[model samples]
Target: MWRPSVAGPRGYRVVENADAFDIARIRPDETAVVVGAFGPFLKALRGIGARHFVLEKDPATLRPDEMGHFRPAESYPRIVPQADVLLITGTTLVNDSLPGLIACARPEARVVLVGPTVPMLPDAFLDRRGMILGTVRVADAEALHEVLAQGGSGYHFFGKYAPRIVLAQD
Candidate 1:
């Protein structure tokens, strides 16, 4: 039942990039290592007293002075095991990195997949535990498409085109 087909604009089937997502509910004292460049989430985590960090693949993308602590993506294996929470963009699913990333995390760690690229299905992920999907239901597909064309992410189009929703296995 879960297959990659024509699901949204630009034909992203397995994942849902064309949808919208919302602000995540995070708790204080949770240590997180984010896998993508989601500045707003990091700020929110910090605001809630969480020790949040970023891991980017391209070191050149980081502003040396502002994000000096940003670590290289290659250290995922090392960082993931020690973190209490793991934040990742849904693009990980699109790029087929979700499985390996999930495998590297401790069973108790809250591994959350954020962004519109997450699929609603939880079939392939049956083996995993403590994994959460931070996704959204598309409010306005046309508006979302327009914003996406303009390079907008959840930060730019949440209320208009998308809203945040969380999914996890009980």
Candidate 2:
């Protein structure tokens, strides 16, 4: 019963960064609230010199320089509403906190859910205030399986087995 046709169409757009469209919108003066201490996104925000607050439960995920911008998870309700953009980790879905986190943002806030765990469900996220989904799609399942079995992370599989794809609501 291996029915390939049973899989639905790939309706969402694939881009470089999930928030590629909104990167420019993250200006120096505007506030960005990051739910997780994801490295690349943090680097990008720092490169932009944008004023941002990172809400992370684990301080170890943040770099020494990033400690200044770190905020406790309890502060999200107060801080999220003030952000012009929100970078939420897809792991929130696994923790059952995605809905609450998404609800904390203002109606017009640019919300981006990023990480390997993010599902390719555009309508579900978009309906919940998400503007972008940053995740990886397996290009070579065998290679990906091999990488995982060897304890390799994105650094090893990305571009070879699992390519980064930013799914957008089109």
Candidate 3:
């Protein structure tokens, strides 16, 4: 089970069942973007048979394991209006990029922000046209670290946190 770190006044809450996330539902024709180069969510995207990804990496050389199945973008200002989903890691460092990316997303795009760093409030992204599809929480830190140290990705830890998918308020 996955749980959100910052829950309501009551207590910690599970957002989604461990088996609920079915990536096969996503159409193979839909384009998606994975911001940043690492994490479990990236692995999840890969398991869902996702292709046509847009990754952001610095000038440093990437290891073969780090690249996974994703291909690099040829240039910046990569306007992907054809994308059906945009998966992002919510961090203060990339706050400014959110609006721009949202603006570029197609009208039907479903935007997901994963990781412990994501803002707790849905209002933060409510005004945007895309749907804020919820997040995944790491319930056990020690296990998470162990998996990472062993070279594991999110797909390996999907049910570790009691993952939840929240539907943004209209």
Write down the lDDT of every candidate, Cα atoms only.
0.66, 0.75, 0.54
TM-score of each: 0.75, 0.83, 0.58
- lDDT (0-100) at residue 45 of candidate 3? 58
lDDT by residue (tens digit), candidate 1, 45-95 = 656777766878876665554285587788888877767878888888787
> Which stretches in model 3 have alpha-carbon errors above 4 Å?
1-25, 59-76, 92-95, 136-170
The C-alpha stretches of model 2 lying farther than 4 A from their native spots are 1-12, 16-25, 128-130
lDDT of 3 by residue, 1-170 (tens): 43332343223222444322232235566666666554455556566666646456452333465555354443324644656777766652255666666666777777665555555555555555545544555577788788878998666765664244444423
Please, what are the lDDT tens digits per residue for candidate 2 over residues 101-123?
A: 88888898888877778887666
- Winner by TM-score: 2
Which ten-residue region of model 2 has the weakest summed lDDT? 1-10
- Kindly give the stretch of ten consecutive residues in candidate 1 with the minimal lDDT sum: 1-10
Ranking of all candidate structures by their lDDT, best first: 2, 1, 3
